[model samples]
Target: MVFRSPYPDVELPDVPLHELLFSDLGERADRVALVDGRTGASLTYGRLAGAVDRLAAALAERGVGKGDVVGILSPNTPYYAVAFHGILRAGATATTVNALYTADEIADQLSDAGAKMLFTVSALLPTAAPGAAGAGVTDVVVLDRADGYPDLAGLLGSTGPVPEVAIDPAEDVAVLPYSSGTTGRAKGVMLTHRNLVANIVQCAPLLEIGPDTRILAVLPFFHIYGMQVLMNNGLRVGATVVTMPRFDLPEFLRVMQDHRTDRVYIAPPLAVALAKHPLVDQYDLSGVRTVFSGAAPLDVDLAAAVARRLGCRVSQGYGMTEMSPVSHAIPDGRDDIPVGTVGVIAPNVECRFVDPATGEDVGVGERGELWCRGPNVMKGYLNNPDATAATLDAEGWLRTGDVAVIDDRGLVTIVDRVKELIKYKGYQVPPAELEALLLTHPGIADAAVVGVRDEEGEEVPKAFVVGQPGGSLDAEAVMAFVAERVAPHKKVRVVEFIDAIPKSAAGKILRKDLRAREAR
Candidate 1:
């Protein structure tokens, strides 16, 4: 059965970032496009375009050009957006790295993507410089503080208007967002200009964003959710993007009241803030019309409770980094779809649920592996054909290793993940990585990690450890051991002493049993 979008078909613009950011949106230049929440700094669309142009020209002079990969490692800030667009305007692929990544992680990503230049904040320079040097990066542009490296602000002022570079939007990769998808290690998800533009168009109808709209962009731009929805989508519609470097409930609520933000693009954890946090009652969130959550499964009950408190509509979407991060979004104000469903496929996207055991299409309403094929799908994983092949098939369908079911109305509901990846605060936390780290702990004899739901209704990693016979090891000590080594979100929250870790005959850890144990 062929499915069609209810929204009118819109032609995607075939242009580079320079053309899209500067040439296309004329006369609306003075409109406030970005607001820095921390410093109260703001940039109009015109000012932003000018900055991007100047920065692009400067980067070009520094030997950055088309097809070259540039790395941007910074938290969500105005500088991050400027550097990102500048990289794209120079016709180079921008690879976003997590600002919290360790030197080893940063070096691995920089080397894998062959990044020629790195744009990072001053505080991260100490970590980024060595990583860039280890990866043979030629240039480092520092944002905000310019004590040590080449000053980004000075370069932008010195450089002339950026020269236009002709580009094939369909063929040229614009953003390289990394993801592990369902299996293996992290690899760069190649999202072309068309992939991004198409996703924005598809998502626009659901968001109902416009020049009057003000979006709270607390979600990290390094992730696909913020990259496409908050940054790119906000730009496409000339909406105001209030950027926050990190998520703090009180600060976020204060900004919402101060800016009168109309829309919020968030992950599952933020829903918890709206639903249960005491700070929510202190501010006026009356201006907010919609709160859209994605990146992880949002409990239907929690979403409803949040919506009731904020007097806004709650919607959930399903996507992965490979899909330019949005495949399905529940249309605002629609109550027709089931509460837990991720809504129908977005405009111009095709999706199917196939049985993993049989490799055959599952009947509607039957749980199966969700597969997506569309312009929004990524080109491929950068430099890893094997991983790409495992994800994307010969027909170009990207197998999203999520077990889901499609209803008669074409709504999709994600029931489970086929992969053992844990999602903490919408970030992917691979169990294998945590398991490896756990084994190195002196107090632990053997360890297995699994995702368990917490009181706030978000997945948190829980570790079950078997201490050496007669060895003293408690839950607090084990949790502290993992917390020091990994990122905050990846830290093991709940630790349990087990006589033996559950495993299959094939030696694979039975995560389901662990999850069942949590239920008991």
Candidate 2:
């Protein structure tokens, strides 16, 4: 049985992403579109539009147009917006690289995306320069001044006519974001102009972003959640975007308080800090009205704690890189939907819950793998047809690989990854559930759960925990704490104290790394 979105289907715009976002800047000409929180600098909507055109013209004059793939490897700043839209406006696909990646990792993505040009900030030159060279990308532009590279000022100084290249919104690729999918090496996810535009429109109403809104963009623009949801969606709605070069808690609070940004986007890990950190009490975060967490599951108790501490509304959503990164979100004013649930299916999207064991669809309240189809779905993984076939079906449904359950009223809650579930004595154990419960303990600062082999070689849940500062949290105590609150099979069977948990820049616990430690 296929479940349809409760919201009315929104009109997916046929115009290219650049046009859909920038064509109507006349109304917001003097309004601030981008702000540099670190420097108190900003770009008006009118100035940003002009810079985009100039840079687009320069790229076109340099023979970069439709079908070309350009790469951006800079951290979040006001100019990251300039470089990104400029690439799309010039009719080239922009593959934004993670700023935290090493030289080799950066090269891998650039090579896989077949990027023709690269852009970076000077602070990242040590990695970006080598990565671009290793990827055989000779055309490099530094968004800030670098000795032997073109700079943003130079690129935007071009007086040449803007490129008149044609873009088929449905067919022309807009961005190439790489993802590891449910399991595998990261592969390029090809998102087209239409895919991007559809998502901006589909989410605008549900996200409640408008001209009067101000978005705190601490999340890196390289990630899809930050790219589409924060940057593109904020711009399409005429909201002011305040950027932080890197996430520092004191600085994040300072920016939020100083800039008076009301809407903040974050991952689950940051939600923990907001809920418990002492430094958060030092800032005037009262200006923040809504805190939307994504990229990974946010604990229900943690969400409530944050809401209580900050006096704000807290919500979370679910998506994978393959689904243009947003398939379900908690609508801003949805009082009927639980705050921790990912809410209803997005407009124009249809979903199916399939029991992976039998490859059959399941009904409401039953746990199953989620499959979604919508205009926001990606075209496919670039140059890897087998992986694409395994993920996307002929009918256009994407096998998300994450298990989920839908309530009778259409609210959806993510269970856990299909591959990450632990099987102990024929019962399934979800690590996310145990991890969330563990986080509620005051002695536990951070925690990750993974399946590990016990004395009899049975797969059991093991927790890697980061204890709170100046606290003595024992393994046996941790196990008892969880066992007392959870099902016998779901209780953590092992515990290891660690100083920190390994995580990606996007704030997802690196389970594979934890598993690797067990293997050793």
Candidate 3:
């Protein structure tokens, strides 16, 4: 059962990403490229291109090119785009770090990726500085002005020509955004220039975004969904992209109202808020023509309710960090497809439903693990062959580890998860990471972490602990212990003290048994 995309394949360009995105800019030189939602500042197409060229030249002057791995640790901003494209334009790999990561978490990623230089803002220097130092990197450029660090204004002051460097789009790695695939710690996903270019081209026909389109980019650009879909796609199509530094519901609504942005991209958590929040009624969201949710599953009823209230087309998509973030999406004109299902596969994609128990292909309407192969798939996990081999096969089919059922018409509905990675508010929270952190506490003798539904029906990490003899650690203490060490989204939400943790003969924590216990 090798299902294929129903749409015509898009012709992928062989040029570098910068060339694909920056060409023919003179025609729309004065048109707005990006808008700073908070400060109302903007960058016109001409100015953005000029700045990118200057930054690229400056980075090259610093001897960063070709095999160099540079890091960007900043929130969503117009300058974030400049720093990102500048890194790629200089013939270096850009690894975007999560803005909310702690210093140690930041250091771990920078060290693992072997990032030679880091670009950040003054706000994040508190973490970025230490992280870079810990990774033995000395060059850290702050995107915004700081007393002692190089700033974007200084970096882009160069009017010198960017050094000429040869690039093979198909073979050159462009960006490395880390992902916890199936089940493990974060590993860098090696997305080459061609992989990204192909994804943007593949999605264009389905999205129908254009020069007149205005997109609200409240989603962080570090994530693939925002990086490629919202930012890069909008730039390539000559659309106006408005950047938001962080997600504050009132501010988000205000920006949407102010910009009259027609296109909105969000995750499932925001969908819930848009459907049920009281603040949504105060703003005029009438200009929003399309609302596309991805990064996690969306509830059918919630999607319908939001559409009814906002008078917009609402849809959801299926993707992962490894698949250039999109394999299927409910196309804009497919009004008949249910919002709960990720509509037909993208152009140039082939999928399969494999029975995990028997390693056999499953037909339509049968639940099995979803596997997909496409031009947009990553080359492999960086420097981790074991993980790459486990996730991607010789035939190029990526084991998505998601239980899915496809209808005869090719709509995909993600029913359950075959992998252990938990999606907490659309963020991947690995149980193994939490379990390892829990084992470090002296008061905890044994621990197992699993995903449990909260009162609002969102998946949250819950820790089942076996306390040491005469230990005084309580639920709040345990929760606070991990909260201080991890990102806000990865914090433990619930804690339960148990006498013993069930395990298999090989001493593996039986997560299924714990899930069954929670069900009971």
Candidate 4:
């Protein structure tokens, strides 16, 4: 028994992503499309469209062609969006790399995605140069020109016409984002042009962002949530987006007050800051009308606190990287959804709750794995057919390893995640990846990683390590060893020395046993 969306199906376009987003920009050409919060810099819609065109022409002149993959490794900036759309305009796939990744990590993803051209900022050249070199990327364009790099300004000087290439929206992959699906190391998730456009259409009604709306984009655009929800959807609706390169609490609030930001899309961590931080009182946030939280479960109390403090509507959504990142969201202007629930299924989405043990659909109000079918779902994982087959089934249903229950009103409340991926402040911290790094330490004999809730009710990665015989390995050393290799969010915050890591007969780490020990 499948549960359908409460909203009517939305009509999706069959054109390329670049076309779908910029086709109607002529009407609002003079409006501010993007703003840099720190520098007070701005980019108008007219300039953005012209920049995209010229950049595409330049990329084509440089030999970027259809089906080629280009990499963008920058934070939220005005040029980031231009580069993103420019790559698509040139009939190429944009593989946005996480700006926080180490050189080795970045190189691994670029190599796996087969990226030929790499675009980055001057500040990240230390890692970006090495990463691009290791990946054998030939063309390197730096937005802020450094020695031995092609300047982005030079790339935009081309007066040549934009490439007029035919695109099959459904079959052509547009963006490749990496995700640790269910359980494994990170693999590239192939999102096609149709997959991205369909999600924007499906979510537009619920978002209802108009020209008057000002979106505060503090979330990193490298993540799927920000890329689709805030950037793409906000642009599709012609809303003004204020981009913050990093999330500084004081600056975030100041930007909202200064820009009169009407909409904010955030994760639970930011929600906590808004609800409890004293600096929130320092700014005039009365202009903020709606707040949409996602990436992790937002506590009911935290949601209420934020709503009460800001005197605005607060809502949460549920999604995964494989689903173009949003399958359920609280409909705009809705006041009926429970505070803790993630709200109704998104438009044009069908979902079911399947009991893993029985392999059957669960009855209403019973917790089970959430399985959804939607046009927003990714085509597959890049170059990993077995992982793709395991995630997306034969019938086109993508099994989201999240345990949830749908109420009688078609509202979904996620109770837990069946997958072992640890979400720390909305960033995915795969335990297996961390454990692999831990084992490389000579002092560590074996290790297992699990997420433990902090005092603020947020998950933090914790590691239990077994030291080598007669080796004196302290908790600090184990924590630092993993922190150096992975991103900050994936860093192990708590380390416990153990005799042996609990494993099943098949030698798989029994994380549940570790979680229970932490609970005790």
TM-score of every candidate relative to the true structure: 0.81, 0.99, 0.83, 0.82
Q: Model 1 off-target regions past 4 Å?
A: 1-9, 180-183, 421-520
Better of 1 and 4 by lDDT: 4
Per-residue C-alpha lDDT of model 2 across residues 1-520, encoded as one tens digit per residue: 9999989999887899989988988788889999999998999999999999999999998899988999999999999999999999999999989998899999999999999899998889999989999999999999989898889999888999999879999989999988843256888999999999998888976898899999999999998988999999999889999999888999999999999999999998899899989999999999999999998889888999999999999998888777778899999988667776888899999999999999999999999999999999999999999999999999999998889999999999999999999999999999899889999999988999999999998999999999989998899999999989988889898999998898877788889989989889
Clashing pairs in 3: none
TM-score of candidate 1 relative to the true fold: 0.81
Which candidate has the top score in TM-score? Answer: 2
Clashes of 4: 0
Query: Quick one: best lDDT, which candidate?
Result: 2
- Residue 416 error for model 4, in Å? 0.7
lDDT (tens digit, per residue) of candidate 1 on 420-485: 768888887877567756765655556778888899999999898878666788888888888898
Say which prediction, candidate 1 or candidate 3, comes out ahead on lDDT.
3
Flag the better candidate by lDDT, 2 or 4. Answer: 2
Checking candidate 4 for backbone clashes, the offending pairs are none
Show the colliding residue pairs in model 2: none
Residue 339 of model 1 has an lDDT of 56
In the range 1-520, model 4's lDDT, one tens digit per residue, is 8999988999888998988888777777999999998888999899998999999999999999798999999989988999999999999999988887889988999999999999999999889989998999978999777988898889999988899989999999999988732255779999999999999998877777888889999888888988989899888888999999877888898889998888998876577568766679999999999998988667676688899999999998888789998899888888888768898899999999998779899978897889999999999999999988998999999998878899888899887667776889998776756765675576766777899999999999999988877888899888878777887888999999989786522133667788879778
What lDDT score is found at residue 500 in candidate 2?
88
